[model samples]
Target: MRVRLSPAALLTIFGNCVKIKSVNSIFDFFSWLAMAILLITAIPQIVLNYKRGSTEGASWLTFGMLFFGMTVLAIRSWFVTTDIIILLNYNLGAVIVLIANMQFVYYRIKK
Candidate 1:
C-alpha cells in the first residue's frame, strides 16, 4: 500500500515537530534578561541611598530622565506580551526606580 500526504498536512506536521523540539521559535529571551539586569542594578543604589539617608552625589535629574524613558518603554512593552512575568518585571522595576528617584529628591531637598 502507498500513502499520500497533502502539502498543508505536511507543513502542519513539520511545524508540530519544530515546536516539540523547542528550537523553532523566534522569541528573544535576552531582551528580557537585559531588562532584568537593569532592574537589578537599581537595587544597590536604592539600598545605599536608604542606608545613608541622603542622595548627596546622586543626580535626581538623571534618575528623572531614566524614569520617564522607562515608563514609556513599559507602556510599549504592555501590548507586546501576554506573559505576566515580563509585564510584571518591567512595570515593577519602573515603579521601584520612580520611587527611588522621588526619595532621592526628597532627601536632597531636606538636607
Candidate 2:
C-alpha cells in the first residue's frame, strides 16, 4: 500500500518541523543584547559629566552620528516583524542618545 501526501498535509509536517517561536526567541535575544549595548555605551559619558559638573569631554558629533544611525534603525524597524522588538531596541537608544546630545549642547552653551 502506498500513501499519498496532500499539499496541506506536507505543509503541516514541514511547519511542525520548523519551530517559528524558537526562531523568534533567538531574534528576541539578539535584540536584548543590542539594547544592553546601547544602554551601556553612553553611561560612562553621563557619569563623567555628572562627576565633573560639565560635559566638556563629551562630543556632540559622536552623539549626532549615533542619533543618525539609531534613527535609521528605528525607521527600518517600522516595516519589519511584529514592530516591537527592533522598534523598542532602536527607539529607546535614540531617546538615550537624544538626552545625551541635549545635555552636551546645554553644557557647551553653559560653559
TM-score of each: 0.64, 0.65
What tens digits encode model 1's per-residue C-alpha lDDT throughout 1-111?
Answer: 899999999999999998866642334466567567867877778888889998877778878887887788689879887878767766886897898888887886888
| Cα-lDDT of candidate 2 | 0.81
Please provide, for model 2 over 1-111, each residue's C-alpha lDDT reduced to its tens digit, 9 standing for 90 to 100: 999999999999889767787798897898788778878878777778878878876777888999898888777787775667567788888888887887887777888
- Over 4 Å off in model 1, which ranges? 1-28
Question: Root-mean-square deviation of each candidate, in angstroms?
Answer: 5.5, 4.9
Each model's lDDT comes to 0.78, 0.81
